[model samples]
Structure formats: structure tokens, C-alpha cells
Target: MACTLLRRLACLALLALAGCTHSDFRPDYPRVASTVLPVPADAPLAAYATRVTAGHGSDSGLRLISDSNDALLARIALANRAVHSLDLQYYMFHSDATGGLLAQRLLAAADRGVRVRLLLDDLHVAGKDKLLRVLDGHRNIEIRLFNPFLERNASMWGMGKQFAGDFSRLNRRMHNKAMIADGAMAVVGGRNIGDEYFDASEGVNFRDLDVLTVGPVVAQIGQMFDRYWNSEQSYPIGAFHHDTPGPEKLEELRKDMDAHARQFSQGSYAHSLVARVGDLAHEVPGTEWAWGPTTYLADDPDKSNPQADSAGLNMAPQIRAWMDGAQHRLTLISPYFVPGPKGVAYLQGMRERGVAVDVLTNSLASTDAGNVYVAYASYRVALLKSGVQLFELKPDAGRGRHGSHFFGSSSGGNSLHAKAIVVDEEHAFVGSMNLDPRSVHLNTEDGVIVDSHALAQALLAIFADATKPNHAYQVLLDDKDRVYWQGKEPGQPMVRYDTAPQTSWWRRFKVNAGGLLPIESLL
Candidate 1:
């Protein structure tokens, strides 16, 4: 009898514990039917890059940059003007000056009835006060959050509450950074909205790149935003305050974020880009920009191959395939590179086939995601021994300054944020895809595969700046197998070293350490 009573008591306690929690994906909202974005039937993925071109960088229409300060500001300004209907999406839109200021410009544009759509990842919005309310209320503005975790009022659930609750599911992140305006011009590539991206970071800013285009391509990107906007993946802010009722004052509060577009000096970063945009659009040569025709290739769960939806046309496989079959030299610039065994074997085979392969990634010191660093490190030896030319960004890139793009310095303006590949002086791939497992298995990212001689030549010019002696660390293992870095100048002797903390050895340890954890695919 005593044992029975004690067992019953323990069972009751367990039931009580289970009753107290709720699921991360709440049920307050209706169970919306899932649907993937339907790709336009008229435009297939094979239309783009059907033809090829080279030596087009001399056309004088391309703008290139190796730094993030005034140059970036120019690009941003042009980006802002390019948008007649702006769709800005990013993971981190900080509340700092850079974010605040960009918000101001965007809000100002919305006020002009330009039809602005802002989709921010919900991680930072959970407890951010007045900010969300004000933005949500904008007249012509629509803001949505992706994959939100809402806490229940304990008002509902039928045994579904028995599951452990999770409010912070950090594994799934929306890492796409794109801006589209006017339906004809789009800026797509690697950039998040923050001080770091805008060069407002006095100590450092991301060494990032974005391409501005005025073509049918912008319409394709616009369709992508429409899918995410209407998907079950995104939720509106009005739904967050369910029973408490959304306040009517959200409208008046919305006007406050638009206080600074005019404050930017005429020649400042934001202003000049706006001026150049007119020129860029005017210079759009309508006579066959692509060798054949252009098509937008995007990821969708429904149409993917293998499972027809599992990996969804990942850029890694696409880029890897391109590298595997390339006839000449292939250069890689992926800040977060993680080539598993197969990726290694594939690259090795390519090298053995006589394709000159070179790679540029953040030195262990400069990476912010240490966990990813470790995953990448596991393949480091495989890459070096494969006879593939391996190079890491020096701690100090951009003219020997600690805060330059030569190294992926978090404090120095240059972080190896470019996700690009140049092949044999013939073609190039630029977009938001980073070469990593997490990016491969998860996340919905987009980028354009341009096979234009002009575009490829333009990309090559930028690559020239990125690989200069002062900006990049040429990884030289020398015949003795001793690891050394060559940079600082053209004729400088190589400096021997094991690893670096100048970028942060701690971060590398953390990344490699994270490799020990069981949920690597989750990372």
C-alpha cells in the first residue's frame, strides 16, 4: 500500500509538471494550410546564364569597392533610390544608430507611399518595447516576423502541453539579406541591417558586397518576398497582443521613426548612392544582358529534387557542381566554409584534374560563429593536403589597417562577408549563399548566377582588390609542411604561425569545440 501511494504521488507530480508547459509553436493561431511559393511557369531556372561573356568590366557601368566606409554609404544611397516599392529583409536590424537611421529613411519612403515591406527575423523583437508598436502601425508599411515563439496565457491545450516548452529556438535562423524596390532594380547579396554593415562602426564594419541591378531580375526577387510574406512562416505584430487588444495609438507612434534621411550630408554614403542609381538605371543596356535569356532560380520546399523538397536547390550543390566541372581556375570567398568529406573529395578530384583551386575564408581569429569555425576546421587539413590553394583572410586587411577588409576583422571594417566564386576569368557567382552545412541543410537563401562577360569582368576587378598583398593572407605551407602566412606587402617574407587570436583563437576553439556537441547538423 505504501509503494502504491508513493508511485501515485510521483505520477501526479509529473502530470503537474507537464501541465505547466506549452509548445514553442503555439496553437492560438489557426492551423494555416502550408503552401510553397509557385514559381512563374513562364520563367524557368535554366534561362539565366545560358550564354557567356568576359572583359566587360571595362564598360564603365560597374561600381566596385574593397572597403566599407564612404564607399558603402554610396552604395546604400543608390540602393535606397533604386526602390520604388522597397522590400527589405534581414536577420539583424539592430536598434543602434545605423539601424535607427536606416529605419528613418525607410519610414520616410513609406510615408511617401512607396509601398515598403520589412521582414525581420523575430529573435530580437520578443521584448523590444515601443519600437515594434510604432513600426507595425505605419500607414504604408507592413512588418512581419518569421518563426515566432509565443508564450501561452495557460488558457489552452489538450495534452499537447505535455511537451517541453522552448521560447528560444536558436537553431533555425533566417539569414537572407536582400533589398528590392521599384520592381525593376534590386540589391541582393550579403548584408544585414546594422552599424557594422553601414560602416558606422568606428572600429570595424563588415567587408561585405552587394550588386545593384535594373532588369527583370528585380521582379523575381519581389515574388520571393511575397511568398515569405504570405507563408505560415511569417506572423504579423497585431496578432501578438491577442486578448489585450492592439492599441489604436500605433498609428501616431509610427511617424516617429522617420526623423533622419535629410540629415545625411549630400556627399555622404546614403546620398551619393541615390545619385548614382539614376545613372545605373539609365545605363541599363537592354540588348541581351545575358548570353541567352535570364531566369530566377530560387529555393522552395515543394519543388526541390531528391525528396523534391528536402534541400530545395541549394547554392552549395550548385556552386560545388560548378567547381567540380570547371575547366580552369576556381576561386572561393566563403567566410563560413564547411566542406564535409564529400565536398573535400569533390574538390580534391577537381584539383587532381588540374583545375587551379584557391579559397579565401576568415582566419579562425575573425569568425563570429565559433561553432561553424570548428566544422570548417575539421576539413582544413583535407583541403590543404588536397593540393588546393588555401588562403585565410589576414587579421588586418585593407591597406594594413587593423580595421580593413583584408582580414575578417570584427573590429576592423573588413570582415570577409563576400560570398562569391570566380572561375577561370570566365564566370562568377554572387549572392547570399555561404558555403557551410547549416546554410546547406537549412535556411532559405537567394543569389543570382550571372554569366555575363560584363558582370564577370566586373566581379574579377573586385577580386583583384580582395587578393592584394595587404588585404589577404596567402596560406603558404611551403615544402617543409610548416604553416606560414604571406601578406603585409608584395615582397615581404612569410610569417610562420600555428593559428591566431589576433582574430581570436578563443573563437576557433569554441567553433571546433562545438563540433564535439551532438547537434552539429542543428548548428
Candidate 2:
């Protein structure tokens, strides 16, 4: 199968180079025997299920995973302790160190007779079909992809073909990320399975946030997983390949994974896992928990379709409810923020009602997505003029932490990737939903709205530290309604930049040039 896929990819590449293409490029991949199993209620995690639910009524016991090490450790701990099933979903899951280690753990769990389910977005799954098929050969493990490309072998060229032949279907993607263990505990937020998400990447560290919850709310998360798993958009790994690994090859794959795990055992990540083994019992029932009701909000799987009638069930409407009901203040943190006219008007209306609106997003220098940044830049003036406080993240914001060797350090750069909102510091929202139109109207998003002021205050504190002058640039409108970035270094004089602070000349030119393009809606 791998050889076959390589041949097809070569053919597609040749065709692409030759400017020869087919209009009917729809892929009719093979399907394998599969079944969507029910989430079991009884598991080892049920022992502490009461602990996480105790005294909180219907609210879940939540802990903020702000540190990358703790975030990775928490997932490892849950995977190790899960006795019944593991349902993992994400938009991006790299085949790097962290992702490989997680796969090793999942394989070990399956060996222990635990059911493992992995669902990932198809956009990033190109060139990984063989690895997925090998994993899917395991009896207890199943791998599926959401809105996958039929041409799985040709990563870039396949995407290009789809873009031209089927733009409407290819444009929408699944951006949700979550990991569930034993149907009792789950982690949901902006972090995907990759080195960058865990601050282990070499070039850039994403300052992200997630919530670890174990309670009744986890059931809803499990249900959300099941819905997407059963949706038509999801396809089993076998659906992409006609051949499956036999027993001998499957054994070889397992041995390879085992060797990889043994190699990782000598690393710091493995040491963290060793220290936190069996710690899930102690992690819950905390006195720090704020007792109140909570709501798990998610968009229907059909929300990916522009014409899908998701109606009030979409995350945008639910999030808007929180934004609309804010009586005093709102703090929004999205890495890719492109507030169109409607968003600007919403914030302005809140300001007119005497509400404070503060926003934090990636700056041009710190942004990894320049096209999205251009769209966001077009709205900065409007947002500022309407009394919206704006702050752009500093590329070097996490340097202190990197130097201290505390938080996970990326290669010499950092950017904000947390998607959260604190409304009046009374209610908090944390999840995969960004404030961009892609998240609001196209991608399926999931988040938990906690009716707890403590959580809100914690998120607010993160926002406060992140918005410091050294970590972020405060955007202000001059008397002439011109834009300028104001920032102050530690124990240094205040400085201002007429252009984006610390941006290169070419980046500035591209941003200015991109602003002229009518791409805000697609951003």
C-alpha cells in the first residue's frame, strides 16, 4: 500500500507539473470494517468521578493547564490511567516526539485491552496514511479523519487539486481539539498534539491554555466526540487504503513503536510521566475549585458547511450570548483576531453601554499567519476608535520563561495561541474557538462556559501578564486617528513605532499589500 501510494503521488506530481488535471478528482477510497462503540460508564477513572463532582453540584472540577509541561503530563497521566476507553481528537497531530510518545502510550493501553479512538482533521493527514493504517491494524485501536481529502498521498498537490475542483468542501475544516480518557476526564483547548503546542518546538512556542475537567461535563464532551465520530465527514483509515497490515507487519510496527517509547523513556518528557504516574486520583477534588454550574458549548458537525442549518446550536450564537450579556467588561484573547464590521459594532455597542472591551491578539512581528494578520490589521483602527483596548503579543514574550527553563521553550520565539474570554470576570470561556470568522462561521468549535468567577479571574490574570508592555504592544489612536504601537522594555524608556513594532520591511510591505485584497471574510 505504501508503494502504491508513492506511485500515485508521483503521478499526481507529474500531472501537476505538466499542467494536466482532471475535473473529476473525487477520491473513492476503500472502507474497512468498523463500528462506533458506546462510551462506557464504568472505568478506573470512575473512582474519583465523585471527587471531581462533589460539592460543585452540576459543575465540573476544573484545573487550568497553563504550563506546557503540566499540560503534557496531564494527558499522559490520563492516558496511562484510563481503563476503559480513550477518545482523542485534534486539528493537527504531528508525527514528532510528543505525538509519537502519545501514540506509544495509546498502543500500550490497547495492549492492556483498553479501546483507543483517534480522530484527526484530514488536512494534515496527507502523507501519513500508511502510519495511520498500521495503527488501525490493531484490534482495539481505530483511526478516523474528519473531512479528509480523498487523495491522501499527495499532500500539497492534493490540496491544490481539491482547492480548484472542490473549493466549497475543501475550504471548511475541523479545527476542534480535545482528548478524553475513560469517559470521565477530558482536556479541551487550543493545544494540538505537536511540539509547538507543548512549547517543545524549535522555532516558536505557543503560549496556550487548556482546562482539565472530570465530572458530568465530561459526558457532554464524550457525546460531542461520538457525534463527530459517527458523522459522514469522518472516514476510517481503511477507507483510504485498500490493504491492511498483516500480523507480521503489525508486530513489526508494534516493536518499532516500543523501541521509540524506550528511547523516549530516557528523555525529560518520560521522567515527567514517571513522576506523575497514578497522580490522577490526587489531581481532582481540589479545594481551589469554584462551585457553580457550567455549560459545554459546541457547534454541530454540519456547521462546517456554509449552508448548514445549525441555527442556535452553533458556537457563535452561544458565545455571542456570553458577549451580549456582559454587563461590565470583556477580555478576548485570540491569536488570529479579524473582527469584521459586525464584531466592531458589537464591541462599540458594549462600550457605549459603559462596558470595557479589551482584546489581545498576535502582532505582525509575532504572528505565524501573515495573511490572517493582514485582515486583523485592517480592523485595528476601527476597534481603537470605538474605545476597544487592543494589545498585540510580543514575539519575545516567553523568553524569560525559556531562559528560566520552567515553561516549555521553543526555538527563540513565542506567540499567543490561547482562545478565551472573561466576561465581567464572572464567567470564563476556554476552548478551541478563536474570534476569527473561520472559527465563528466555518470550522466546528467547542468550549466550556464556566459559571465561576474564580476561573474568570485566573484567565484575566493571564491576560494581564500577557498584555504587559514587554510582552505586548498597546495599540492607540493618535489625535489624527493614525495608528501607533506603544511599548516599554523592562527598566528602559518607553518606545513607540509608527509601523508594526519590530516588524521587517518586507513583512510591512506584504501586510500593507494584503490589506488591499478583499479577503477579510475568508480570513
Candidate 3:
């Protein structure tokens, strides 16, 4: 998602001002990084690999990581246990506490002779090139950015000018997120590296989900990472910099990273991870396994800049096939849902054929993306009238049953970020793809389709909890054909709203006004 509207305007002003002062500055575009080091396929994850392979036959071992703390802990464990290599990719890797802690771990892994490759989208790479370049100097570590901006050293205005001239090329982004360790295990989901994603943020925390998998799926994920790592869009950090870091600076960076990791390891968070991975490490018995066939789906990296003649390589068509096979019901959990006319008509047909369709998305008050809510609100009545059950997640969701531990806790607000689909209680999908136009038409996306009844039940249970009265407000129209929000409060009568009751009047006004803009496709 782009920055908040207000922030974007602020940035635009800064860029405009900078262009006046530094119009002559120009930066060089770098060459691609070296190819990924060969994977030692025979090197198994010490204690974890045997259990995933033995007794499971060709089936993959799948486990869900719903808790923010646990999800981060799983990543730390996988990194700590990786033997041969680690390939980590993300759209955002903030230099906050979480990012710093993981950076420390990755550096240590590299120091120990493990090859580590980090690929990130260029949208968030502004102002961080120097720091990343220092890390790239490490012998065993390499850093690359995807589709970087050309005027790397330009002032804000210079950037704005460059963006203006190259809007279409710079607008498309790589929104894929995944982490593979030692070719033996992988974690894929809706998370980016930040304190908010791992329950450490005091502000807005996300209710996100990720899956840890082993077996044949890991190999497929490795291949997907290679495709992007070696793609034309990726460029080495060394290419943008004048030269690699000198010895003194590299030593200082290493020392700072060591101190950060030492401090993090002494904290309760690291202690908890140390305990869980040990307990969770073992062979997953057949009875406990969610055994089934799995298909990994990913849009071609070049799909970000779609060409009419490009091979038909997209995740949408593959996803449509799964939807087509839904025999009973369809459940969707998308944070930024803009099911346009065609999507609505398709769902209507499904309902007509006796299929139950349910959707869970963010309420105007809960959503972090205001413009997106505007676009989605325009389709509310149409979706409801077409027999689609709709629920908007409460800002205070994850407060019942599971509480903060279920979703990451925050004092400011809570919003849905997970993108998943459940079809007919037989299959489930987990990934970074939202059901918005941006995901389908502009950005590169990826996901996994698991044909496991057990996993399906787990996801359905989560959906049930999320849609409960205390967790969400049902969107409905009264007898007078007026749209209102409805939910019951504990020890009180049910409540209703002419508008989103949790949001302030000003916020609602801003969102409604944004609906008038001609940017539904962008949202």
C-alpha cells in the first residue's frame, strides 16, 4: 500500500522543494547481483527435517503461525537453524526494533559461513541505501533492491520530478513476502519485517497470519525466490554505491549489530522463542498432519509491468480455478477488498447456485487505508443485496477468547491484514495478495493452495472468531433501505449506526469525500 494520503502530500511538498535545490544531481543504476549460491539440498534442518519427511511420504508438513510473537519466533528459529543458505524477500523491512533484531541474526548467520540473500522492494528503500550497502560488504551476505528509483541521491523535488516523468514504471511494485531457510523450510504470509507485525508495536498492530511449511513445498518456494533474485528488476547494493565499505566502517557496523542482538537475546521475547522451537521441534505424526496436495501460485515478476505478448503467467487465473471448484461455500478474508462489477456478478452467480459466500474486511474506522475503504464502501449495498454476507472487522477485534495473543496487541487500533480464502471446507489459501485491483493488475503477488481439511477447519475457526459480534460489525440495510452497522455490546442492547459507529465524524466525512475521486482502480 502507498503511504497515508496526508503523508504522501507532505512528501510531495518536500520533493518539490528539493527539486529546486538539486535539479542537476543524478545517480547511476547498478548491475544485477550474482546468482544465488547453490543450495545444498541434502543438508536437512537438523531436528526439524526428519519429522517433516519421514512417515509423511510425499505430503508436506504444514503448521499455522497466527500469533505475532510466535511467528517472529519461528523465523528466528529457522534462521538460527539454517545450515546451508537463507533467502529472505519482503516489500518492507523497517529499521525498527524488529528489523534490527532480524538484521543482527542474518549478519550472524552470514558470519558463520551461511550464504544470506536479502531482496527488498525499492519503494521503502529511500534513505537506507547507505546502511544496506554497509551490510552488503559482508563476505557471506548480499543485498539487492527490486526496481529501484533512478535518481537515488536526488532531493525530494528531484525525486518528485523523476517520479512524474516515470510514473508508470515506478508505480508498479513487488508486493511478494516470503522467507526460506536452508532449502528445508519456508514461511510465507502477509507480514513485513517491523515491530507492528510481531506484536511489539504500541500503535496500530495488524491481525496477520503466516504458515510454516516443509517438504516438497520448500523446494518450490526456493525456485520462486531464485526467479526474482535473478530477474532483471533486482540490482546489487554495490551497484548504487561508489564502493564497498572500508574496513573501519564495516567493523563498526558489525559491532553495533552485535550489541543489538545481544540486547535482544537477553529480553523475554528471545527467551520465549528459544523455548517454543525446542518444544515444537519433532516429527509431525501422520494423525496430526494436515496431509494433502499443495500448489504454489505466483505471478511472473515481469507481471508488475504487464506486456500483452507475455506468456499467460498470473495468479488470478489459477485462483479462479480454485473458486470454480467450490461446491458448497466460499469464505474470503481480504483487508483491501474492491470486488468490482465482474467480481460481484461472479459471486452473485455462485450464490444463485446455492453457494454461501461470506466476506470479512476492515471497517472504515478500523482500516489504515482510508481511500481503499472509500472504494470498497461503494460496493457494500450491491454485495449485500446480491446475498453476500459482509462483516467489517472491529478496531478492537482479537479482544475475545484469543485476545492480544491471537492478534498482535495495540493501544491505538487493530486492523485486518491477513489475505486468505477458504472454499467448501476442503481447501485454503494463504498469502500476500489482497483482492484489490492493485494486487490483481499492478503488483506481483504469490500464494499457496493447500488441499487439507485440517488446515481448512483451522482457518474457518479463525474466521468464525473474527466475525463474532464483539469482533466485527455486520453491514446491513434496515427496512427503510438505509445502510447501518449492527453489533451487540456485552450487558447492553444491540447497537446500530447510520455510519461506522467507532469512527469520528470527521474521519467518516474524509472517507466519503475520497469516494468521489476517480481512483478506484488505484485503490
Candidate 4:
């Protein structure tokens, strides 16, 4: 790929740092084979904004497409179909089956003379940049790294390391996963470039979701890329990537990718991806995409984001604003739910009013991030005491561990990775911003304040229609004068628990202990 002079300079800077040959580390890219899929003729977010040309012509074209399972792959395939350009930005890009499949698709797109640009965070490049370099050097592809730390520079592991660490910038990370194709359509949401993220889960897959748009929002997605691309903060991988061994090493990687892809092709996740693909694209026609209002936005380290705040965006204040502003109901879904005292108070206050509140989070045994689950476990009493509707997904649920469903069971593997809020179902906010402290106070989050009745309703409709069981549990005082609980779903009757937590002794210890740790500030 023809890199810019600025990119060349960055390459040189990285080259001056330390690295070795690429044959040393196993690449993270996985693979997934071909499959059928459904397609959605969803409208872009910008279509509803002010118009200059009227209809789709006046709009900015398709800006984003969000989906879990097959829906995500279908959108990616659409981008792969683009002959002109492809731009990708993400925090992590694994070398797994799904990852390799996407890579193959991108390479195929590149073969069509498309301009391919990839920007990835440096945090994950450790011992793996060489394989990426081989691809980055492709005639039609260019890659860059953001906020990298040169690992080989340390003479030993002590003073040199400390000195280099001081000089290097590694505190912040780029967590956005964005894709823009041909400058006509874009996808801006929470999925990173990985197999589990894109539905290669044989055991289970992330129950993640994203938003897609076709309209002027394309400009926003592209603009975000343009800004980050040209920013000094981004470093080119050319110089940073060390040399690779002979074709033997390359062949080994290729073999692993192929095998992984074969595995996923037979997995349930691949089937789901195929189905969603067909659903979203088979019937759409004309210059205009399906119609609805959507917003494309980007959140960096800004004064408004909690990560940028000096004292941090305390859960109390931010939630109070969101809750105090709520006119009807607030529904929050976070895989990892940790509501501090302020969150409890805010939700309680909302309950005191006429507002209805509901919360969805992973069960203790089901959560992949155990620490966060612990924090959430500790807050159970606080939430139940305040009269909030609480739902805990069963460990065996499809959207449980690893975000995938039971292999042969009628389960949904995709977990609730959505960081969203439905306020009266009239307006919603969907983005990488979780309700947890890390999102509100420590991590850089981004989302748009969507003001569209149709879109909000549609999203709520999805939340409602999906038979994804929501087990509601209410805290109770038993006749024995001890606290207990009952769990109920839509069709099933209530199941009682001897203890209010419905958890094991070990699980309780883990969560409560995690709650008492000093690292609550970090997710």
C-alpha cells in the first residue's frame, strides 16, 4: 500500500524501537468459511436529518450497520464487496477463525483494487505485529498502530523498562470498532475484530449488538477515521512491525487460519451469521436505503466523557441526570453491572417517582469478567431494596459465557453486550458506553442521543420480541424471618431460593470481596 509521508515517518519511529522476527509468536487471527446470510434494507441515521436533495439522494448514503451473529458478518461482507475503499479501526484484532475469515474477505476486496486502511491499538500488538506486517505490506493495504510501546528497547527488565515506560505513551487506548466502505456506508458500534465477537462461537458467542446506518452519518464515521488517521497519535505499522521468517512460518499461519475457518463453518454461529446476512440484504432496492433516523457519533477523551473528567464522572451525578431526566421508564442492559451507592440511590429515586426501571445483567456463574460480576453481586440488595426490576440470564442461557448459546440446545449464545438505554422507548442511546464505573468514569465512551420515535420503538421491539428469557427475581423475607427470593419469567412460574442471592457461598465471597477491593474505579 502507498503510505503517506506522515505514515512513513511513523514507521521510521517504530523501526527505531525494538522488535524481532515474526516467526516467534502465534498470530491471533482465526478463520470462518463461506456461508449464506440474510440482509436488511435498513435506512441510514442521516436520512431523517435536514435534507438537500430529498429522500436517499439528499441523505449521506448508508452510514452504519449493526448486528450480532450473522447480521455482523453480512455487513462485513457488504464492506468486502466494496471495490473502492475500506477503513477499519478497533481496539483488538484477534488471529482466530472469524478474524481470519474477515481478513480473507478484506484481502479479496483489496485484490479488487480497493484502498484498505487499518488502524489498531498497540496494546494488543505485542509479539504479533509481524504477521500483520506481512499483510500490511500488501500492494493495496496500509496499517497503523496507535499508542504503541516498543517492547525490545529495555536492556534488561528494570531501570531501562521504567525509563522507557516513562517516555512512552500507553495510558489511553482506542476502543472504537468502526468500518467505512467507499465513503457511502459505515458501521459504528461496539464489536472489535475477533471471532467470538463476530459469531465464530462453537461453544457460545458474544450476545453483542451494533447499529447500522446509511445516510449523512457516513460523513461522521469517515470524519472520525480521517481525524484519527492523520493524528500524530497514530503510528504506522511498517516500521513498528519486525521482519518475518521464511514462507514456512507464513504457511503455518495460513494453515491454522484455514483449519479454524473450517471449524467455524460447521459451528452454529456461522449458520446464524448466514441467516442474518440474507435477512438484511436480499430485498433492498433503489438509491434510498430503508428509512429511519439514526445518529453516527464518536467519543474520544473529551470533557463531556467521564474518562476525561479530573474527579471523574461520578455515577451519582451522571445517573441522576439520566434518571432525573427520565419521564417514564429507564431500561439498562450491561453484561457487567456494578451500581455504586449513587446508582442505587438514583434508581431508587426514579422508583420513588412514577418511573419504571429495569436492569439486565449476566448471572454470577455466567459472566466472563468475574470481577465485575462480583461488584454487581454486592449491589443486588441495594437494587432490590429500591424496587428495581432485575433480570439475571441463566448460565445455560444462549447469551451466557463467551456470548454464545448451548451447542445443541435451543439457546442463544449471543449475550447482552449492548450498552444501551431505552427512555420511554421514545429516545435511546447505544454505544460502547456501559453503565458501569469504567464506562462512566474511567473508559472513553461514545454514543449519540438518538431522538427518533420510530428507531427507538424498533429497538425496543427487538428487546421485547426476542424470546430471550428475562428471569425476574424479587427479594423476600421468609416465614423463617430470613431473606429469600423467587425467580420468574414470562411463561414459567416462580422458583424460590433459600437465600436471597440464589448463589453459592463461594460465589458470594468472590463478589463481596471484589466489591471491597480498591480497584473499583477500573472495570
lDDT of 2 by residue, 1-523 (tens): 9999999998776556435333322357554434334444455576677555766666677777777767777788888988878899899988888888788888889989889999998888865767777888898999988877666556566567666555677688898888888877889988999878776677777889988887778888888888888887887877666566887877887898888878878986567656743243355446755555677788888876656676864778878877899999999999999888898888889999999999999999888888899888778888898899999999887545423222344446888788999999999899999999888877888888888878887788788888888878999989999999999888798898898888889988987887888777677
> lDDT tens digits, residues 1-523, model 3?
3569878997787566545432222246455445445555456473456555677667786777778877777787777777778899999998887888888888888888889999999888854677788888888888888877755654565567666656677788889999988877788989999988887777888889888887788778888888888887787767665566876777898899888878888987667666654323234454555667777778887876644344675788789888999889999999999998888888999988889999999998789999998888888888888789999998876555444345554455788899999999989999999999889888888878998999888889888888888888999987775789998765567888887878888998998888889998876
- Whole-model lDDT for model 3 versus the true structure? 0.80
Better of 1 and 3 by lDDT: 3
lDDT of 4 by residue, 35-104 (tens): 1111222222122222322554433323223345544555555555565677888888887776777777
Question: Could you tally the backbone clashes for each prediction?
Answer: 27, 2, 4, 59
Task: Provide the lowest-lDDT 10-residue window in model 1.
Answer: 44-53
Q: Report lDDT (Cα) of residue 24, candidate 2.
A: 23
Q: Which portions of model 3 miss their true places by more than 4 Å?
A: 1-47, 153-158, 265-288, 306-311, 402-405, 409-412
Instruction: Please list the residue runs of candidate 2 whose C-alpha ends up more than 4 Å from where it truly belongs after superposition.
Output: 1-42, 268-284, 399-411
**Candidates 2 and 4 compared by TM-score, better number:** 2
Per-residue CA lDDT of model 1 for 111-171, tens digit only, reads 6755667777665665462565566566666677775546423233422333234312434
3 or 4, which is superior by lDDT?
3
CA RMSD of all predictions: 7.7, 6.2, 4.9, 10.6
Candidate 2 has which clashing residue pairs, if any?
A: 30-239, 202-411
Q: Give the TM-score of candidate 3.
A: 0.90
